[model samples]
Target: MARKRLLLAALAGVCVWGQAVPDSPGPAVGARVPGFDLADQTGQSRNLHSLFGPKGLMLVFFRSADW
Candidate 1:
C-alpha cells in the first residue's frame, strides 16, 4: 500500500511538471500584438495583420478538444 501511494505521488509530481506555465502577462488588453504567423486549417500560412477587416478580428482559444 505504501509503495502504491509513493508511485501515485511521483506520478502526480510528473504530471504537474509536464504542464505549461505562462512566463509573462502575455498580450495585455487593447495591446497590439507584434504580429504572428500560423497555419490555417487548409495548411496555408496566415498572418495576424491580414486577418483583420473593417470590423476587426475576434480571436478565440480552446483549452481542450475533449470539452
Candidate 2:
C-alpha cells in the first residue's frame, strides 16, 4: 500500500540522516569572526561592514528580539 511505502521511505531517510556527523564550530578565542548580511527590525537589509570596519567585527546572536 502507499501508506507502507511512505512509512518505509521516512524511516530510511531518518536512518541515513542519523548517521551524519554533528556540527561543532568549537569555541572562539581572540578570533575575528566573519561578517554576514541581515535585515534589521525595520525590514531593511544591512551589511556588517556598514557597522564595523575591516579591522574588527563581533557577532551576537540572541534568542529573542528584546535582547
Positional deviation of residue 58's Cα in model 2 after best superposition, in angstroms: 6.1
Where is model 2 more than 4 Å wrong at Cα?
Answer: 1-27, 53-59
After TM-score superposition, what is the CA distance of residue 61 in candidate 1 from its true location, in Å? 2.0
Which residue pairs in candidate 1 collide?
Answer: none
- Cα distance off (Å), candidate 2, residue 6: 50
Per-model CA lDDT versus the true structure: 0.75, 0.67
Task: Judge candidate 1 at residue 49 and give its lDDT.
Answer: 82
The prediction achieving the highest lDDT against the true structure is 1
lDDT of 2 by residue, 1-67 (tens): 8767866866786788775533324344556666678888789988877777667656666569574
Clashing pairs in 2: none
- lDDT, candidate 1, equals 0.75
lDDT per residue as tens, model 1, 1-67: 9767866867776688865544333686578777789998899999998799899998766687586
- As a TM-score, model 1 comes out at 0.50
Model 2 quality (TM-score): 0.41
